[model samples]
Target: MWKVVVVALAGLVLAGVGGVALAYPSLAATTCPGCYGLTELSPGVHVEDGLSPAQRERVGEVADQAARRVTAFYGGRRSSPGLLVCLTEACYRRIGGGQERGVAVLNRSVMLSPRGLDPVIASHEMSHVELHARLASSAEVPQWFDEGLAVVVSGDPRYLAPESAPDRCLVAPSGPLPVTLEEWLRTASADPATYARSACQVSRWLGENGGRAGLLGLVTRLNAGEPFSALVRTR
Candidate 1:
């Protein structure tokens, strides 16, 4: 069985499987072979593919719904217009499968397994793509923040709890508040509970503080090299 290999970055960790060495650029480049969308999102990221016509339509529906949610959440920001959706098992395998899903922001893409997710759940994964693109590429939003927002945006309340937290989100407490970003990335994996709580907190904070507009500001601040400590402090 293939295992997960996680790559860490500015407090975010992406899960990959096997020694397959799926180059990020190649995997990111896996658009519809010959088709690429030329919009603000440019070369819209491929989600999953290799499905029957019905499945393809379903994937497209899921993608469209997710796009709406992202736009609603960050209407003020410039988001990629479309997301290439795929649903074939083979397509999942080509990218990797140990992890439930993967999102590549550089190429403005997202990939997921549609085995058991409902449209809402799949939309959640799509939200991750939007978040990845909207947030400052260099911001230290923290893994919990990233995964948490994805879950919250999906509209699933379960993700607000630790036990129900996503597999990749990890967190630990060094003192009293919660595990710092440094601790989260340094740890082997995030603690499920801490991650959930942090995500919920951030989501609520963004909503109450400035709604989507505030969230955009936070992401912009992070991308501009503002201290996460200052930005996240509101949360």
Candidate 2:
């Protein structure tokens, strides 16, 4: 029953991830009983588990596997300084990763638990990290685009639903999807079904177009600071 969700910097905006609080407690304001620095397991993959050395190793193995999956997903097109996967309650709370965001990727790192670490979750956050690496700014990316692409690239099962059309690549649980991407971001996350809908729509878009090639072109344009509206016309 523990389906994974990834909260991208958009806090699900990027990976269809959602729900925890927005504020991050100062690092100094919080500390784990057995605080430890993140350990580098594989290239650009890090893990910090306060439980035991054996647990740390286990988490590291999972992270390494996820990292490889992510790299392969993009066909080795992207990377970052590193990725941090933590398994400390204190760290989770401080970073805002609870039921709302069990697996989230923030500006500083990616937060995860052994219970939450899966290929889908890991790859979703990895997509966000790589996108940010490309965008490289506070440059806004539409929530639907972010979350949808994460779900698509992560190969999450929820995205298997075959939506009808590429033009239909938009959703809102209520009141008609807002007029603007910004407005959609403000409203879409409120609905619990947001992630699944987004994944379906995005998958449809990728399929209707030219698969990864089309996706990469769109990503490149977005990184160049193109607006999401330019790619998908919504009236």
Best by lDDT: 2
Deviation (Å) of 235 in candidate 1: 8.0
What residue runs in model 1 are displaced by over 4 Å at the alpha carbon? 1-50, 81-86, 105-107, 136-138, 161-191
Off by over 4 Å in 2: 1-46, 49-54, 94-96, 101-108, 136-139, 159-189, 223-225
Task: List model 2 lDDT by residue over 81-147, tens digit each.
Answer: 3445566665556544565333444533466654566666776776777766666474566666677
lDDT, residue 23, candidate 2: 41
Give all candidates' CA lDDT scores.
Answer: 0.52, 0.57
Error of 1 at 137 (Å): 4.4
User: Which residue pairs overlap in candidate 2's backbone?
Assistant: 12-17
Which model scores highest in TM-score?
Answer: 2
Whole-structure CA lDDT of model 1:
0.52
**Tens-digit lDDT track for model 1 on 1-235?**
1223232442243334212244543243343323222112224534443445676556556666766765666663355533444355555555444345444334355555546235555556566666766665576666656666766666555545343444322332333333455765444255446545655566656656676778777777778899877767532
